[model samples]
Each structure stands twice: as structure tokens, then as C-alpha cells.
Target: MSAPLEFTLLHPANLTEAVKQMQAHPNARLLAGGTDLVPNLRRGIGAPDTVIALGGIDTLNSITETASHVEIGAGVTLAGLLASNLPTRFPALQAAAEIASPSIRQAATIGGNLCLDTRCRFYNQSQWWRKANQFCLKLDGDTCHVAPKGKRCHATFSGDLAPALLVLGAEIRVENAQGGRWQPLAQLYNEDGLDHLTLAKGDLLVAVRFPTSETRRSGYLKSRVRRAGDFPLAGVAVALTRTGDKITDLRVAATGTNSAPLLFDDFADVIGQPLSDAALTQINKRIGQAIKPMRTTNQPGLYRRQMVAALSKRLISTLYEQGAN
Candidate 1:
């Protein structure tokens, strides 16, 4: 049986206080919505000595828009985004956020979703289950059950918003007690699943900023076992600009296929061409070759790989149709 969770909870009044608390207790796990962290804690994931609550910090929950960009606070709930004008303003982000069930949307924060832990069939089970199966590389065991001979873990990054944000060219603002900095959202993750995020000790994800442009068109597509409440098996997000039926700028990103979400740099090659069947076929082939899905979920790796192509084609076709109309 699992031991009861025992830890100190700290409620910070503001962002400053939150940062201070995090800096003071480097081992404290920051809790925003607790949709993911709480479950992991119950599964005996990381036993942090302290849990710093960021939900009370009002500034972290506000959404601000300027002439240049829209800044969404980390604490903004998925339901809040859906209810606000954000869906109309950024349809792709809205579509991704809408994938979670209604109840989860009400409680899950954007920041928590962004920093969600890498998941695997072996790692997410109960303590008893893990013990019975023998711990995998992500837990206490040295060997990766997914790839026993491989040196690293094979857990998959399963967040839905990350691919959308990456294709939109969003930037993340993170702060610590010492200072703060902004980076492209795509840079926040590494290929290693065990240590997926680039966040440092005491670092807090403040907000995500998306550049505002009238010419941009975007779409998001997800494939999961169920229509809702299930993490995606494969997903795609695409953003582009079209000038008189010719692609001007394009970005494509995928999630749930690798250790970290991927932004396809070669998508730029599709620019200056029309979104015709020939062009899409080439793009589809390129995407199929680029993504490397593992057998982490119950679905076969080949099926997940095929879904990547299928979803990419679907999203691109939808975006193209929207542009034509």
C-alpha cells in the first residue's frame, strides 16, 4: 500500500511571494491547478517537501492583450480560455485547449499543462502496480522497459497545448527569484523524456506570448482513443500565411510522437507554393519521415506515425480551405 502524502503547503499572496517561496525551498513543487501534479504525487512520483500554491496570485490569472501580442497568464484555466474571446482570436489554441474534458478544463491551468510530466504506460501506474511490474527508467529502475537496451527513458510528452503554441511561434516568460527571461516555447523542452523541461530550480512559468498578426491562419488536430478526456496519441498544429493562394510563411509542429514536442524546421520549404495535392503529398511524406513515434502507448508505433501524417494533412487541408474562403 502507498503511504499517505505528507507535505507542507505554502500559499503565496503574489508572484513575488511565490518566487521567494520557490527560491527558498528549491525542492518545493509549484502547484497551479493540481490536475496533473496531485495524481503524480499520489502515485509516489516526486516527494517534494513543500508544495507552493500559485493559484492565489491574481496577476498570474489575468489575460492581457497589446497591439503586438496576446499574453496569457500561466494560471489561466482552460475553461477561462474557451469562455473568453481567445478562441475567436486564436482558434488553434482554443481547439487544443478544448480537447480536455469540461471538468478538467475548469481546473487545469495553462502553466500546469505546459509543464506536465512526461508519461508512459510503465510510469503512470499506482505504486503497487509499478512495484509489481518492476520500476522503469522514469522511476526507481535503471532499465527502460520500453527499450531495455537503450540508455535513456522513452516516456512521451503528452501535453496538447505545446504543439499549438510551438506552431504559433509563442514565447514563454519564466521567472525565478534571481531574474526572469523569455524564450521561444519550442526551446523549453529537450529530447530527453526523464528531464524533459529546461526549467531550472525555482523557475516559474509566468506566461505565454503570441505575436499578433492579421495575416496568420492556423489549425490544430488531435488523435486519441476517445473524443474527450484522453491524452492524444498523436496531434498536429499548423500556422501559415497565404498571399493570393501561395503560402508565404508556414510552421508545423507535432506532439505525443516523441520525448518532446517537435517543430518541423523543414516546413519552411513549403513556402512559395500552393497547398495543392502535390505539395501536400510531399509535405506528408516529409512529416512521416521526420516524426519518430515509440510504442509507449497501447497503440502501435506505426499507427501513431500514420496518425501524424493523417492529422497533419487534415489540419493543413482545413487551413487551406479556410484561407480559400
Candidate 2:
């Protein structure tokens, strides 16, 4: 067993109080759902001297829809999102919420999902298991089991919500001891898995905002090892506008294939083209060509690459049908 953690739980009632506590205790960590943190703590992954619990912060637990977008509080549970009326504004996000189990949905928050720690076969082990391996770079040792010659950690960023948010052009609101600010969702991610989030040490993500738009259709498709409650070994989120059967704009994002969600707009060229099997096959090939998944998950990179194209086609097809509906 690991040594006991010398930590204090500070319960704050509002954002201001939470910010103040975090400022005072820079070494402390914010405890939201603890769906992830608690397991990590017990496994000796986190050693924070204090924990700021957001359970009392009621202000951060609600979701409000605006005229042009939806504001989801950081503390809003995944179950809350799934149970709430699915927002037509961000369909891909709704699909992402459906990917997790019901119990986990009730406990996991959107903010936690966005800031989820990167995962790896070697890094997720317990201290005892790591000790057996003589410690990997993610924990203590100098060597990396994932890539012996590589200097960087190749832990996979496995969050399902992030890719959806990326396609929707969402922005994140973050608060810290210094102040609060907002930025595009893409800015919050980094290509390096060791420190996946670009958030500062003092920053806390307060909310996620999804902008509203007309004439845009979106969908999410995940290719996992299993059908129910399985993390996507490869997934795609596509949002685009169809103007009289021609794609006017497109945003394609892929996850479980890179350190951050893979995004590009070049897919819009398929607009104005017919949705015949040949056209889809050509477009699918283009998507496959764009993504070169690395060796990281249960299946090899090639299998994931194929899945990416297949799922992308499915998502696009579904989006087209939704547009008709």
C-alpha cells in the first residue's frame, strides 16, 4: 500500500471562493467528480497537499442555453447532459456523452472529461506494478516502455467529448488565482501527452460554450473494441453545412489516433459532389490518407486508420440524413 496523503478538503460554495482557495493552496488540486482523481490518488499518481471540492459550488452545476449557444457549467455531470434534452446545437457532443456507462455518466463531469489525463499501457499501472517494471518515465524511471528510443511519452488522449467540442467550434472558460479567461477549445489541447492540457498550473476550466449556427449538420462515430461502454480505439466527429447537396463547409476531427483531436477543413471539397458510392469511396480514401495513426492501442495503427475512414463515412452519412430530417 502507498503512504497516506496529507491533504485537506476545502469546500467552496461559489467560483470566487474556489478561486481564492486554489490561489492560497497552489499545491492543492480541485476535486470535482473524483471518478478519476480518487483512483489516481489511491494508486499514488497524485500527491497534492490539499483538495478543493466543488460539490458545494452549486453555481457550476447547471446548464443554460443562450440565444446563440449553450453554456454548460464545468460541474454539470455527464449523466446530466445525457438526460437533458439533447442539444441540436451540438449533436456530436451528445453522442460522445452516450459513449460512457450510466454510472460513470452520473459521476463524471464535462470538465473532467476535457482535462482527462492521458492514458498508456505502461503509465496507468499501480505503484507496485510499476515497481515490478522498474518504473517507467511517466512515473519515476528514465526509460519509456511505449517507445524505448523516443524521448517523449506516447500516452493516448482518450477523451470522447473533446473531438466533438473541437468540431463544434466550442470555447472553454478557465479561472485561476490570477484571473479568468476564455479560449477556443483547440487551444486547450497539446500534442504532448505527458502534459496534454495547455492550462496553467493555477487555471481551472469553469465552463464550455458551444456556439449556435444554422444550416450545419453534425454527428459523432466511434470505433471501439466493443459496442457498449467502450472507449473509442478510433473515432471521428464531423460537422458540415450542405447547400443544395453540396458541402459548403466542413470540420472533421479524429480522436484516439493522436495526442489531441485531429482536425482539418479540406474535407469541404467533397461538397457539390454527388453522394454516390464512388464519391464516398474517394472521399473515404482521402480521409484515410490524411490520418496516419501510430502504434498506441489494442489494435495496430493500420486497423485504426481503416476504422477512421469507415466511421467518418458513417458519421457523414448520418449527418446528411439528419439534414434531410
The local distance difference test score of each candidate is 0.85, 0.78
**Per-residue lDDT of 1-325 in model 1, one digit per residue for the tens?**
3664899999999989999999899999999889899989988888988999898999989888899988999999989877888767667786646467898889898899889999888898889899888888888888888889999987999898988888778899999988899999988998888999999998999999888763468778889998878998998888877777887777788889888998875765577888888888888887777677887899988999989988888888878777642
**Model 2: lowest-lDDT 10 consecutive positions:** 267-276
Predicted structure 1, TM vs. truth: 0.96
lDDT score, candidate 2, position 190: 83
Off by over 4 Å in 2: 1-6, 87-89, 276-292, 321-325
Q: Clashes per prediction?
A: 0, 2
Q: Estimate each model's TM-score.
A: 0.96, 0.90
Residue-level lDDT tens digits of model 2 in 125-196: 688987898877777888877778988777777788888888888899999877888899889988876777
Tally clashing residue pairs in candidate 1.
Answer: 0
Best by TM-score: 1
Best by lDDT: 1
Q: Cα deviation in Å at residue 236, candidate 2?
A: 1.2
